[model samples]
Target: MSRLDTQIETQRLLLRVQRAEDFEYFAELQQDEEACRFIGGTAPRAAAWRKFLQMPGAWAVQGFGMFAVIEKSSGQWVGNIGPWHPEGWPGTEVGWALRRAAWGKGYAFEAAVASIDWAFDTLGWTEVIHSIDLDNVGSQELAKRLGSRNRGRGQLPAPFEDVVIDIWAQSREEWRARKR
Candidate 1:
């Protein structure tokens, strides 16, 4: 197994290990209600820190997890894009989130394409899933761009009500074909 910091680089971003200092920006981003509106809602500082600390373990156990997406040009942690294994999904789910300042740019799509390609080609993952809330048009669009076809409603239930997430997925073989 490779070390956690074996940085994954794309054309414009570098997905790397989480640092303690990242939580400040991570918490800030997570606290943004608009930024997290689709997933659920933002978390408090303490909760966000807990989540950040837990990420490395997830990577250790599953060989993958949400990675801090850093913009190589400025060395800023712009977002996170990778496989998410939230309970309820039958398969491994791929998810992403970026700060509001990073929106409207091609960052999300670019990060996703790289992750999906690596998940299939390099990492040897069989398939990838996406659990996106139905009304999260931005995420839904991003999933589509990744060549994932809508599967169905997600297991993310109430307080998250009215937010019946849609599932999207693609297999390794499928992803390879799409890239050609």
Candidate 2:
């Protein structure tokens, strides 16, 4: 899909492909300790800038990347969620990381379901995976709610390769069947 056409809406959220205007919010998310803890821990603004650029870059280079999630109720940039498979990655991952303020509200699950559907139906992905930090109980629970099983351990790309995580996944067939 063209960058402008990458928009997915749900009952309470709008998932749009990342754009330059989203940098500030994205940077804010990366700088929040609680929010960035499992992802890569907090970073300074300079580092956050590089990280912010990755989402849009992924869409440009990989054709699929995290969606800048906006809450319909508040029209706020809550965080990002969707497909992510950087070089040397373990799997095509459907991941999520919301600003700390957006946690515990079911936004991640809601956006994730839409993302997974798009991945299977639009992106034609055979399976979807989530690399979750072993200690991230919240995400593990969300993965369970989505019918994903903790398959095993997995590795990430360089700079993060050493940070192993649990690979939670389900086939596209399983996801479609579960969504029914």
* Candidate 1, run of 10 with poorest lDDT: 154-163
- For 1-180, candidate 1 gives per-residue lDDT tens digits of 575765778888888767776777788888999998876688988888887776677778767777888888988888778866644445776678898878987988888887777677656789998877777888888888888899887666445445666778888888888889
TM-score for predicted model 1 compared with the true structure = 0.89
Q: Find the candidate with the highest lDDT and give its number.
A: 2
TM-scores of the models, in the order given: 0.89, 0.95
Write model 2 residue lDDT over 1-180, tens digit each, in one string: 486469999999999977777778888888888888899899898988888888888988878899999999888899999999888878888999999899889999999999999989888999999999999999999999999999998877789878879999999999988878
Q: How good is model 2 by TM-score?
A: 0.95
- Model 1 steric clash pairs: none
Model 1 CA deviation exceeding 4 Å by range:
86-88, 156-163
